[model samples]
Structure formats: C-alpha cells, structure tokens
Target: MTAIALKSTLWSLSIKPFKRKGGTNLLLNASDLALGLRGIGWNWSQVHLAPETRPTSSKTTFVLWTLASLCLHIPVFDALHYAVQSFGPTTFGTINGGSIFDDTLSPLLRYSRSTFISFLSGLVIYCAIRITYDVATVFGIVVLRQHPTQWPPIFNSPWRATSLSQFWSKRWHQLFRDFFVGVGGVPMTYMFGRIGGVLGTFFISGLLHDVGLWGMGKGSDAVCMIGFFIMMGFGVILEGFWRKVTGHRVDGWIGWIWMCTWLLGWLNLLVNAWAAKGLIGSLFIPDAQRLPVKIFGPLS
Candidate 1:
C-alpha cells in the first residue's frame, strides 16, 4: 500500500507537467516576475526606513562600502593561503608553485612548526582586515548617524548577527536570492515540483559562487563551492520532505540546523586558519592577529 502510494505520487508529479504544454515556461516566467517584485519591495523598504533613521544621501555609505570591500579582500587572500597550504608539498610541485588545488586532508592533519607559523600569520592578517572593516563601518554609521541599509555599493554587513537568510534577504547581495527563486525556483517548483525548485535555486547559487571565485583567479576554489551547493541542495530536499511528512511546514528546526551547520563550518575555517599558521609560520596569521594590523597598518 505504501509503495503504491509513493508510486502514485511520483507519477502524478512527473506526468502532470507533460500534460500541460508550455506550462513549465509560463510558471518559470511567473517566478521571475515574482522575484523582481520582491527585489523592488526589499529595496523600497530599505529606502523607506532609511530617511527615518539617517541621512538619505547614500554617497558616504557607498564610499565606506567600497573601502570595506578592498579591506575585506586582504583577509580573503590570507584565507586563500590556508586553503592553498592544505595541499602540501607534492601538490605544490604539481602546480608549479602556484597555490591552487582541492585538497581536503591537509587542513585536517596536525601541522608542522613552519606550516603553523605561516598559517598563523595568514590568519592574523585576515582577521585584522575583517576587524578593521567591521570597526570602520560601525564608526562611520555611528558618526554619520546614518542607516547602514542606505549604504550602497556594498554587498554585506561588517557586523555580526548576520544570518544566511538575513544576509541574503537584506545585507549582502540583496535580492540575489529573490531573483534566483523568482527566476528559477518558483517556476521550477510549479512545473517539476518542490524538489526541482530547490535544486534549481541551489545550482544557480553554486554556479554564481564558483564563477565569482574563478573570476578572482581562484578556480581551484570550485571544490568548496560545489560542496556548499551539495549541502544546500540536501538541505532543501530535507526541508521539503519534512514539510510533506508533517502536513505543514518545518522551519524552526530547519533554521536551527542551518545555523548550527553554518557555525560549525565557520569554526572549521577558523581551525584551519590556525592549523595553517602552525604549519607555515608567518605565511598566514590567525584571526587573533588581525587587530594590530588594522590599527597599525596604513589607513586608507
């Protein structure tokens, strides 16, 4: 009986789309439209809230974000060192001294003295850069008495409390998710079912992340990028399944799980940063060393 029910559900989902010609395209287009509207709505909301809190002029915000972006890159480069050093000496030879490759194990292993030092250096540099960006952004907002949302030309927040959802929804790369879900997810869901919608969204996001990394001359970063997509895809499928089984929605548990996962991932990254520093002294500094550099380094 259960098997038959499962088969019936699958058949219904798969065949229904074929029975309606052009329906898939139509639904997809609708999703795209919905996403666009959502984006506009979010932007409008930000604008509406902006005047009440701070200056309406976004020029100063834009300038700060631009500076923040440049500063952010310094740590990103340092993070890359840990990622790169994880490949070890053999991979280095294979790449002709170029720092690129997908080696998952190096980060897991105990570090040598030199490797540790380098990783620590890189980690410190990265942390310093990140801290500087955060502090500067906060100070600017407070001094100008301006709303951070009005800050344009910036993609993400420098402060904490930013979640994946919130970050996607408001702070960093606003409307990107809306556009993806609107353009790809909603349509795919209607045509192919929720699974399709989820997968479609995940795939597009992964592709974009990969492209961004590749554009930065970090093509080897694809491994982690792909891993991220896989995780998200699984997450989507699980959420859908949970909803179906419960005959309603499942968010709180899912949200908690997502947060836990994100934190764990971040912790691992931090550990990797420290390990990298231990393995290669001065090659990278851990997050701890970020402060002094930000304070002492040349200020823009």
Candidate 2:
C-alpha cells in the first residue's frame, strides 16, 4: 500500500544521512536511522557517546534498579548531611564576617570529619545519580521505544581517576564541562592560547557556581566555590607542565594517592565553607542526631 505516508506537506521530506538504498518501508527506515545514530553519534567536546543497548530490561530488573537507587540514596544523603550543615541563608554562599574556622569544632576534628564526608559525598552521590539516570534512560529508550540508546555522559569511573586533570576532563561529572569550555575555554584559547582557555573555563565555572548559589538564595557566600575551581584550573596547568617535563602522567596507585591527597588535603578550605553555610548538612538530620538510629530506624 504505497500511500502518502511520512511525506509531510508542511515540512520537507528529505532523506536522512544513514538510509540505505531502496528502503522505502517507513518503519524499517526509521529503525535504520536510529541504529545509525546509535553507532556513530558522539560528542568529544562533552565526551558523551551512546552505549550498547539490550532489547529491554525485565520488569523485575527495572524495579530492583529503582529500589537500589533509593536504598543507596538515603545513606548517601545522611553522610552528606553529616559532612556539611543544613541549608540556611548561609548554607551555600559565603557571608560577611563569617568563617568555617569560627565553628565550634577544633581544626583536628573538623578537618577529619569534613574530609571523610567529602569522600562519601563525592563517591556515593555520583553513583546514585548515575544509576537513577541510566535506569530512566533505559526505560525510555529500550522499553518505550523512544530514544536511541541509554548511555550517560556524566561520571565515568571518576574514583579511578589517577590525576586531577583526568578527573575533571575525562571522569568527573561533566554536565557543565562543555558549557564552560565553549563559553570560556574556546574564545580564551583563541585570544591567549591554552592557558587562557584553562583560566577562562574555570572562571566561568566559578561564576556559574556562584550564580547557582544566588539562585538558591545563598548568594552571600560565593568566594569559596569560586576559589575552589580557580585553584583546580591552576592545578591542571601545573599537571600539564609536569607531564611535559616528565614525559608521563602521575598514574597507578602512586598517582591515586597523589590525587586523593592533593584534593583532600586542601578540602578543608572548601569543606569548611560548605559546612559553615550548612550546605553539607542540608540533606538529613542535624549533626547532633547523626546517630544511626535517627538516620535508619528505632533499633530494629
């Protein structure tokens, strides 16, 4: 039945780039289009690529996935809450005449606790978000027959990242990576080469974080996050220089130790600020109620 189907009079019925010859069947044509995109579509700038897909997940598998995400999220949230403070007017952004140093906790205890919290927040939160997103993407693409594939581009085994540069560029959550690069890196590089690009990218990220804090009504404290990214930009430059000098990157267990130490050692600066503003503790019970019973259940 050669009817006037898929020939949109309002729009141009141009052929797609991936269609094979003599494939007039609209259903098969669409399927080929999807497969073609899934195979070749990639964005190096954002480092996002489609992953291989299964036919569909079983109903039980999908349910289990969701339950796992929720189950994991509670503990993740609790840990984050312990590391930081509850959200208040000052929970995110920095305020005048206030310092996390001024908090009651001594430097020893504060640093130790905040450092542990940071690790948990970094690891668990990223995983939780990834699992949840992938599950949804799977359902939409495979189950409902909507999108092409379900691979996500956010975190990519960041815990395995051997260096700060790799962590930021290749592994860590890269949701805003392309945005920062395009808005700041590209033009700055054109103007002043790679260094300019790095500075611009980190600067833009800092501004974005500050703006986000403001949007959340915590604009009063923006310096800490800004400083954090700016420092990261410089660290990247230093690492690049080191690589050029040494002809190799800081890799392996030694590199991992270096990376974690470098990040966590200075974490007190940012963590303190986050704690002061209650951003770290914004998820669950207050520090006083950080007991397992309060977080889990009544001793059952």
Find the candidate with the highest lDDT and give its number: 2
lDDT of every predicted structure (CA atoms): 0.45, 0.56
lDDT tens digits, residue span 185-256, model 2: 877999999989998889878777666555545544567777877888887887888889999987888778
Per-residue lDDT tens digits of candidate 1, residues 20-51? 22224565444333432222223222211112
Model 1 worst lDDT run, 10 consecutive residues:
43-52
Clashes of 1: 39
Judged by whole-model lDDT over C-alpha atoms, candidate 1 comes out at 0.45
- Best candidate (score: TM-score): 2
Q: Please report how far candidate 1 places residue 202 from its true position, in Å.
A: 1.6
- Which stretches of model 2 miss by more than 4 angstroms? 1-45, 48-67, 79-110, 124-128, 131-148, 283-300
